[model samples]
Target chain A: MKKQLQSLKRIGFTVGMTAALAASSLAQAEDKLKVGLMLPATGTFAALGTAITNGFKQYVAESGGKLGGREIEYFVVDDESDPAKATENANKLVKRDHVDVLVGTVHSGVALAMAKVAKESNTLFIVPNAGADELTGPLCSPNIFRTSFTNWQPGYAMGQVAAAKKAKNVVTLTWKYAAGLQSVDGFKEAFEKAGGKVVKEMTLPFPNVEFQAYLTEIASIKPDAVYVFFAGAGATKFVKDYVAAGLNKTIPLYAPGFLTDGTLEAMGDAGQGLLTTLHYADGIKNAKNDAFRLNYAKTYKSQPDVYAVQGYDAAQLLAAGLKAVNGDFSKRAEMVKAMEAAKIDSPRGAFTLSKAHNPVQDFYLRKSEGRDNKVLEISAKALADPARGCKM
Target chain B: MDFYSFLIQVLNSVQYGLLLFLVASGLTLVFGIMGIINLAHGAFYMVGAYMAFALSSLTGNLFTAILLGIPLSLVFGAFLEWALFSHLYKRDHLEQVLLTYGLILIFEELRSLLVDDEVHGVAIPDVFSASIALNDTLSYPVYRLVISAVCIVLAIGLYFLIQRTRLGMMIRAGSHDRDMVQSLGININLIYRTVFALGVTLAAFAGMLAAPISSVFPGMGGGVLIISFVIVVIGGIGSVWGALFAALLVGFADTFGKVLLPDFAGAIVYVLMAAVLLWRPEGIFKKG
Candidate 1:
């Protein structure tokens, strides 16, 4: 009878332990927050995507690997910078993985598609890099927020700078794409407002780097200055070609910051003394920026660029919302309200969201100097996107 | 545009055309002689550009980089032909396409692994870096002129190699009847290998020449490949002279089209291709 009682006790202990373990795991699952990161991991934008991921994870890791006392679980999907696969890729994270919040994307077209998916599912989405105007304009929603500027902001700011410099008749050149077109429109809006006339606008097909024919045309037009919108390898080639063609000697070239940002190193001496406007520069002096830059360099072994800053700010915005709602995503409306209203202390500096949920930030005029985009001045202070078509 | 500016535009078109010819001549030769469709021809161009970037940095001179890169690419071409392309010659067009297409991906991935995805600029030699002032506002880079000159010399060399030499006769006969040339005990396989190597060398050499001006970057090959194919198609599949003519025509159309019809500039090349096909379905020249 004693041996049988001992055996029964052992069985009871085992059952009790099993029940407790299951209960704890269930609670942990409920408490943890799921975040899906859909960004390009391959193709042209791959490096940008990796930097963004590092910045996001760096913020999370700084908060002891949790946000607002909730453990963060991450799911990643490579959108491949292909807009055609954007819907499918986003769905894999939202409907399939059932993530609570979605963060993505560098390519504007892919980001727009991801925004569509996020809206249909009523999931919270934060755009880290893409600057598509429609995201904040026609498609604005309470659950949608962007940590980056519109494609219009930097261009418009540069236009003001160019006008102040007394460039009376300017010519513009860019690849014929939505981003390029919108950027030129923004420049035109501000320049024309400042009594500056655009003499000519020339464009080639997208991803075509052959600019000799166009350079020849620009030479003949002889505008006071030339403005262009090109990024990555195209930007590098254009700057080199422009200098090589001796156009830079005769015509002052201007652009939004993308012309010199990640491409300055490859551009070598060709990009020297070139001026551009953007939301971030390498020499912003503040305790916040200083500390952020130091910590990022320590963690990643590389200096954080505009993309990394945007990614960090996305996490910061999410953290603000999570903190307000006490880590309960069921209180999503309250969380989103907190996100919209939060004044994020970004590495780019402090910025607040506009009514359309785009960043209302300062745009800086930067000069390319020795592989650095050195800050010249604040070109536009507290610049807000018009968000022309938004009802929200 | 004034006459001087028009002259500048013509000069630009010819220079651009010559560069395209350097790449397309190889594509035509490979197709015409080897009977193998090399989709990775552009990738070879990219490889050459990257080689220019890598070797120039090491040797500290673009000229030396080209000098070293030629023999290396020749050996690479021969090895590729011996190991992979030789097997594909006996296979169907679909299989050849599949293999060469796979090669493009492999080459791109290898490039990424070796060089990373950052754009790199190869410094132009000091001797050729200056620009000749065309007028008060416009000047053309002397490097571009050097490029045209080199391409012209290579074109002459290629012509002589194919038209004058005993090897050229053998190559011509082989293209006409491969079995007959083999029965003549000419070691037709060795000839094919030499021809393939020469084609690769030309394409790579074009890439090297373009590197300083173009700014080496990922996917640089893709654009050039499509245009090269158009040149190949328009010039007729196996005709080098036809390729030269077609490339020049394309260059003029593209340059003029950009000036006159900016909105339709992108479609102009394809439009030219469509017009050519309608006029001569097999292209501008008959097969060799």
Candidate 2:
């Protein structure tokens, strides 16, 4: 009688475990859309990653918590700001979790690594940032789509503008990194084509706080203008030091809008009258961008940066593609086709994909001025990205 | 190269070397006397810079800012020792390393929370902002020259204090034989605290001098900290004059390495360090 009771209990336990498994599968099938976000969430680039995550969240909330009628699930993994770690995380996201789509990564090198994995898996990779030109040039892949401008786009546009302004002698100070090298190179090429002479070229280290020696060198050079290629804290430091070095009155400093922002509000009047070029400034007068600016500020209680805007656009583009495929991720070719159509409304009027599947968009020239201690745009001009040999 | 241009570069190297000595000395002192490899020493330097920034902004006087910041840093050093570091005195080297590493994390996080990661840098004061023209073609910042002068004065003062004073005698003794001095009833704890505070003050003053030239931001201390550690090790860990000489060696190596082999600037220092260590494992100046 005891043996009979033990057999019955074992049967009951097995049935309960099977039932739980069936329930979980049913729940997952009904409401699953796994999306992966890989960014530098834990290292030096954490500040930018946090901003990207916030924007990603804002987009999900505004999309009614669903994409293509399926409950959206996102795995935001910290890549630790390393390219190798980014690749490792990408494997886990694709192989382990079986995420249908991937988005994110702000570093160009990290983005390139992920692009390789996405190509291997035949997964749709929506890059919201990472501006290396080679990603869309010789390194182009069919599985990747970028909503952000390429590394060369803004600098090339700025070069043309500087040439138009009839600037003669220009000095360039850029970080000693691949992205910095490409940006400065782009500027140099375009500026020379525009009939401007690059008098001096200097490369500063990343996250470098020291500028005095370089500034002293530039002072000695006494160029007609200085073009800066530094982003993040480097940008903040460059602007303050430029002004404080009292070069404001002596030499004109020109940089991309990535180097200046409402964050300059922290610098007070020190940020005033700095000239820059960019793809989009917060002061853009376009109706679509204007609305985005208002909604973003209302939601986050802070000004939306280029990273935030790119994040929002990446989500919208993914949603459009999913909608076109009728939520069928198994139809990978169809999804890729729909994404290549580039039908979403980006903040910068409209950014349609080029042959490389990278966005062919407008770049802007802007200047920073202050009112009520706020960094405000005092001037702007729009220009388009120059066509290059990039076949995807 | 022409003689004049060569002279200018040499001057640049020397000025940089002198500035490095200021920070490396403090590191050497703490490590030599206390046997605590304080990695967060660089964070104290950063704190000094921030203090100078705040005080300068508040008082609109450069001299006043330096004066206020040095004492504040000294007091902070004392507080840090009393609250946390003292407990690790009897522990092994690994514990001291972990605790100091934790301190670095806490300090960096606190700085980020307080100031945000956006860059913060102090500017050269108006009176000293002009560059001195070496010739019609070359000019150098007056501020760098001022930094070199200040470093020289401090170096002289430190030499006098260490060689001629009674406190210096006790510090030297403690570094060589802490247990023996303690048995002699020399109040070892008090001496350690004072020595640590002095070391911290020197590091902070270096930071204050550096702020006008470098960008001040979270994690800014990390680079300096590593370099100072290398300087301490290469100089025989706790040797003051060794630190000075090693610092100058490093400064020259860095400046010249960048000019000659820009791609290998990061590795040159380590390569030099390895060569030195291979020659003398206990360093140029050992405990004795």
Candidate 3:
């Protein structure tokens, strides 16, 4: 009886394999759009990745379960925010899954690895969150487009905006990383050019949360303003600690939008009136934004944050490219051109792609008001990355 | 830095040192007493922080949340000891490390599934949220001061328990000769289980107390775990007093390093550890 049962199970497995193989060719003829989501699905950046995925899926739903009149199938891989596994994961998407396009990533290091894979595979990749300047500046590719702001852009904008606000002497604090270094460099350049002085710079190693000693230093130095770069939990702690230290009252605290992005929920009243610069803001009054916001909140059951805007715009960018090529992705050049020239009327604002394929968008000077980024004004308009050293 | 600034940093160092002691105490206990190298100790801390976050929200009171969190943590720790570590008492260090490392992964995945990866803040109770003004411009958070005070009380209590109590006597005897202790009919298994559970509870309690200032999140455990291991090693494994002294040394070194050499702050702690090792190869408090 056992032998017969084993034989019967073997026969069932063979029949199922035959059915799936037979259907493969039939399904291929339909030519569904394959999108690979290589975001960090379960780590420090998991919430950011979740927002990006949500925005991407919401657009697909809004577009009647299709992008560019083609049914889309998604292959999602959690990048785990480990730079070592990033290329391996991207290779799986490009080689193993043969995905038509790749959408990813939150960590700058991991995203850089993904960019390398995109370059080698010539696979169209949309960056939803990571803002490494090198992706557009030195290693810009015709195949890559970023819906997010570059690391330098918003920081530079913040520097200028703060300078205009009469914060002539600012002290900067952040974790030491490519993103942090580049952001501080960008801020210093603009701030000094606007006749400001950076008294001193202090940076701890990346992912370190203890900031009390540094807070003491800042209090002692007593800079006119504090410009910091922190994200997620670090940002939450820094804001809370900074305020608790009583520095915010005397030394106006400023940072790139990362200090507030997706962190307002955790920050609570601690972030109120905290001015920040970012490519997206809450009070961007427009029909396009209204529709996107309504749909996103309705779908996700929460207010859409900046990260979600980037993800939604990523989907919009992809849809535009697919539509321009009439969903014939085989016309790779035309699709790439379409994506490169794509003008996105994002929830943030109307942003067009630069020659380097990074977003040439307005940076909004926003003030955090009761769990919302109230748009004060445009800090910088139509800011385009220099894309220095890029042949493109 | 001015005198006032230096004074503030000193306070920062002490506050940080006390918190480190709270975390490393439990790590040293299990390593010193139970003869088990449990890398999953940090996972217990992370879970405690997570539990505090959840219960604080559900109970709407930080004190009440902690009241519920401790026993729950104790029970969880006891369960882990009974189910897993009890069998690993005689296992080699490498096997114990590998097993506990696997447990860390399991606990992290379990946490992620249950809580997702959102950073949650535990609002300090009103009583502890107040600030003590050091000067016109410099003020310290009351929560931090409270943390230092609580850790002092804990250290004294832990010292008296280990030195004066019957369980402490048994634990000391077992650490010296487990087989002899067993032969003496002292239920060595129960002692191991109790010590292991107490260590876990202490680590979790540290996490709970820290949630307000640290702001609970994923991967927070890993950082504390590394620092705790450093404390255990430098203080001599299984020596609570060594853990305390080493923790304060690291805390002061780290705080001063960050202020003096922000760029090299990350390496300074390890440098101090290396220097200490060069002086005393087996740690400052290692016995025999």
Question: For the second chain of model 1, what is the TM-score against the true structure's chain B?
Answer: 0.98
For residues A230-261, write the lDDT of model 3, one tens digit per residue. 98889999999988877777889889988887
How far off is residue B3 in model 1, in Å? Answer: 1.9
- Candidate 3 chain A: minimum summed lDDT over ten consecutive residues — where? A22-31
On TM-score, the candidate that comes out on top is: 1
RMSD of each: 5.7, 4.3, 3.1
True contacts kept of each: 0.77, 0.06, 0.69
Residue runs of model 1 more than 4 Å from their true location after superposition:
A1-28
Worst 10 residues of 2 chain B by lDDT: B1-10
The residue-by-residue lDDT of candidate 1 on A25-137, one tens digit each, is 65777778999999888888889999999989989988899887789988999999999999999999999878999999899999999999999999999999999899999
Scoring model 1 with DockQ, what do you get? 0.67
- The superposed Cα distance between candidate 3 and the true structure at residue B157, in angstroms, equals 1.9
Against the hidden reference, what TM-scores do the models get? Answer: 0.96, 0.87, 0.94
lDDT of 2 at B68: 89
- lDDT by residue (A132-240, candidate 2, tens digit) is 7777777677778888877777777777777877889999888788877777777888899978999877775564445555665666677888888876556776776
Candidate 1 chain B worst ten-residue window by lDDT = B279-288
Candidate 1 RMSD to the real structure: 5.7
A352: Cα error in model 1, Å: 0.3
